[model samples]
Target: MGLDPQSRVLIVDDFELMRTMLKRALGAFGFTNFTEAADSNVADQLMVEATVTRRPFSLVFLDWNLPGSTGYDLLCKWRGNPRLAELAIIMVTSESDREKVQAALKAGANDYICKPISIDKLKEKLEAVGLGKVRSA
Candidate 1:
């Protein structure tokens, strides 16, 4: 989608390589701003800190199976927190079970993208969230 190049974004995944890949995928969509977290604990800390500082993330790409808490747990936590309730979250997972998809959507994920993500799929999810499509990529 047409993400603001300066839009503050967060990538939360235990695997550094996955995080890097996601970042690169987003880069193609012209997203430059990003913060990476290895697990939910770190993501929580960053969220709290950012909120306190009045610079909350504009978007978050969360991995399903994190080291401490699953992405679903983090999604629930953020959805319940008034301060972070409006943050856009997209669950990125390798699993594509229907129940899991429903659970994520019901739990307040802005969107969900399967792993080995392609630019087209990411664009589609972003569009589903009303972010629209990327201009060049």
Candidate 2:
């Protein structure tokens, strides 16, 4: 299935500006539903609550660094849970090492995007993950 404009998205990042930028980028692609978490604990809680409420997030933009837990840890934790396994999670971070990318993929990240994120790159990743057929900018 392609990207649904109505799909709920979670933006997990410690920086408020980063979250706003991500949300703006997604908005360009017609996505309006969004939730923000400044740390892993809040992110995890929101994810579970959404799932339990039958309003699970369809996608997540998770940062690599956080106060309590790293994004990789969260990724692995969610992937290991059957209830959260299907969430399309994209690791959004400053880490550009090949090993890090591979590790995130191995841990079950649907895609990865390095900062400072470009709209073009974001669109490409979204398309690759079957989110949608994004038109060229």
Candidate 3:
């Protein structure tokens, strides 16, 4: 199932490098409608703007640990908001403990990808959880 190229994807990370890497990975996979935020505050703002504008985002790739609010906190915030809770969230982080992954899943991450993400892995995970917004012929 191919995702619509017009659909939106948001990337949240404190490091510009991670954001750039994710953007490159997704772009390599053919996802065109993408947005990035270097911090939790900006990320929250994006979510609010998207929701209030009634243009709910399709996918969000978030870092597990951020400067202030952890990605888990942001996930909780989004999950608490009914309108935003429905959005798909994928956690991208360096932590890969089974317990942490389980906790994130319990907290409502649609899926979680550990640090050093791979293009093929991202594609499979996105598709598995419905972020496959673009595909090759």
Question: Best TM-score goes to which candidate?
Answer: 2
Model 1 stretches astray by more than 4 angstroms:
1-3
Q: How would you order the candidates by lDDT, starting with the best?
A: 2, 1, 3
Clash pairs (backbone) in predicted model 1: none
Taking all chains together, the TM-score of candidate 2 against the true structure is 0.95
Question: Model 2: C-alpha RMSD to truth?
Answer: 1.3
lDDT, candidate 1, at 58: 80
lDDT of 3 by residue, 46-71 (tens): 99999889887888998988888899
Worst lDDT window (10 residues) for model 2? 128-137
- In model 2, pairs of residues that clash are 3-131
Q: Tens digits of per-residue lDDT for model 1 on 23-108?
A: 88888878889999999999999999999999988889999999978999999999999877667899999999999999999999
Residue 113 displacement (Å), model 1: 0.8
Error of 2 at 24 (Å): 0.7
State candidate 1's TM-score: 0.93
In order of TM-score, best first, we have: 2, 1, 3
RMSD of 1: 1.7
Candidate 3 local Cα displacement, residue 71, angstroms: 0.4
Score each candidate by Cα lDDT.
Answer: 0.87, 0.89, 0.84
Better of 1 and 2 by TM-score: 2
**Each prediction's RMSD to truth:** 1.7, 1.3, 2.1
